[model samples]
Target: MLNVLVTGGNGQLGCEIREVAPEFADKLRLFFVTRENLNLESESEIETFISANQIQAIVNTAAYTAVDLAEKEPEKARSSNVVIPKLLAKIANRHKIKMLHVSTDFAFDGKSGKPYKEDDLTSPISIYGKTKEEGEREVLKELPKAIILRTSWVYSKYGNNFLKTIRRLGKERPELKIIYDQIGTPTWARDLARVILKMIQTKDLSGFYHYSNEGIASWYDFAKEILDLSNLKTKILPIETSEYPTPATRPTYSVLNKKKIKQTLEIEIPHWKDSLKVCLSELD
Candidate 1:
């Protein structure tokens, strides 16, 4: 069996990976580590962990994802998104092991009227996006064979995500206003987790790829779907981006085209509405 180390063990994606690990038990022995368990800041510590566990692959999912907070803490964001990926890539290269790094669709400025493809040029507008983009470059510089997966609007039953937040607010308030200007796909963490596992098994699969649940929706549509699925009586009101301001500027449109990954993996992706239903069912 291949020994695989998964970072961000407590995050939504990591949790979903943990849930589905048993299905790949015959081929993969997955080791999950959170910051509490592993000192990611120290290179020696990560090197020692890899050597000790005989790890053959590394999935780096731990990232400084506090988008608005990142603006105030650029250094911290750089450390997590850029420095850490470079360190892991360096170590993985030394060990000649497979590595998969997760990234965000915010890498783009979102001015692209069309869906972004794998080769689209990235012009990040926020500190969080810039750091993530830099991290992708750092990994590629260290380990040319490492795979990078960029996804958008990730949510799960675990963690404080949009879906969960909507569910909570919908229960407490009868009326809610959400952003309708920004658009992207809502990716189920479970779906992304399954795709990651598949990529791990595919030989010579390395480079940047995009993955998200099929179809697209604005935040308002996403919130409406969640309330509808949960049978909540909350009324959702659509508002423009100007109405709700954040420290970080979000792309008006950040939908990623999944044709490359779909063709490469030969798998059909689930639509956002369908995946939303599946994820909501799990929450029930």
Candidate 2:
């Protein structure tokens, strides 16, 4: 059986993997480990764990995802986003194991008018984005066979994401204010997990790739869609980015160009709105 070690087992993507791993029970041996079991902060510990286990592949989903908080605590974010992944990449290279690393759309500055491609010049505005970009570079330099999948606006019922936040706020408040300037695709974590599994099954799939649901929507549009789908009696107010101040400066247009991944992997990607409905139904 092919042994696969998944880090960040409690995360949104990781939870989806846990649910789907049963299908590959006969051919794959999956081991899910949370931060407590395998601390990324301790490089020695991480090296020992990978060396001891006969792990054939690794899916790293652990990251310091707080964009705003990363501004204040850059060191903490660097450790989780950059340091840990670098260590893992080195170990994976030595073991000749396939490593899949998850990244964010924030790695781009959002200055480009069109969808950001895999080869686009990255100029991150926030600390979180900078650190994630650093992590990607380190991984590529260490493990050429590793796959870095960059996704945007990720949400799910299992984790704390934009969907859950809007749902909770819509229930508690009468009106919600969301930024209308920022445009991107809302990626369902489960769908992304499925894509990852499909990529693993395919032969010779590696390097940096972009993966997000099809169609683009601003934050306001997404909020309205969520409320409409959930049958909530909440009103959504569209506002500019200036209205609601945040520590981190988000990209105005972060939609990624996913043509490369789709063409290379020969996989069909679902539309953002369609996947949102499926996720909502699952939540219900």
Candidate 3:
């Protein structure tokens, strides 16, 4: 059976992948490794672990995702976001194992005024983006067969994401201010996990692909939809990105064009609002 190794097993996306792995059943042997078992920052540890397990395919969901905190901890971010993947790619190449690296839409500067295509030039605005972009390049360079999937605004019922944040804040506070100027698609971690599994099933799938829900919405609209679906009484106020200060600068429009991934993978994507409903339903 094909053995699959997934990193960041405890994270939002990683947990969803673990939950769905059983559905694949006898087709693949799945192993979920948390940070303690597979220290990403330690190349020797990762190499030792992979060599011992004889992992066939690596699904790298590990990343430094704390955007604000990344500004203060650039080295840690680089180690997790850049160095780890570079090491994995080298090891995967040596072992002839397939690698799938998860990336973000933050790789772009958001100056294009339209949805970013796969081949568009990347100009990262934050340290987190820079590190992630570096990870993508390093993986592709080391293992040409590796697949790099860039997603945006990932959330789920499981972890610390925007959906849960809004849910918690909506209940605790009477009003919330979300940015109206920023526009992007909200990708449910569950949905993305399913797509990644499908991609793995296809042996010919490789290269950079953008995976996000079909439609786009501003943060304000997204928050409002979340409130409406949850039947929350919180008032969501729209404000500019400037009104809300964060440690890292974010793209005003980081929507990704999914045409290449859709055609190449022969998969259908759900709309943003539809995914939001499905995710919210699980919270009940």
The candidate that achieves the highest lDDT relative to the unseen native structure: 1
Highest TM-score: give the candidate number: 1
Write one digit per residue (lDDT tens) for candidate 1, span 68-127: 999999999999999999999999999999999999999999999788998999999999
TM-score of each: 0.99, 0.96, 0.97
Each model's backbone clash number: 0, 0, 0
Pairs in steric clash, model 3: none
Give the lDDT of residue 49 in candidate 3: 78
* Model 2 spans > 4 angstroms off: none
Quantify all predictions' global Cα lDDT against the true fold: 0.95, 0.90, 0.91
Which pairs of residues have clashing backbones in candidate 1? none
Residue 21 accuracy (lDDT) in model 1: 93
> Looking at candidate 2, what is the lDDT of residue 207?
86
Encode model 3's per-residue lDDT on 13-45: one tens digit a residue: 999998788888768778898888767767688
Q: Report the error of model 1 at residue 162, Å.
A: 0.2
lDDT of 1 at 41: 81
Candidate 1: segments with Cα more than 4 A from true spot: none
lDDT digits (tens) for residues 1-284 of candidate 2: 77788888999889988887887777777778898798876768866777677888888999999999999999999998999898889888988888999998999999997999999998999999999999999999999888999999999888789999999998999998889999999999988987877666566878889999999999999999999999998988899999999999999999999999888877889999999999999989
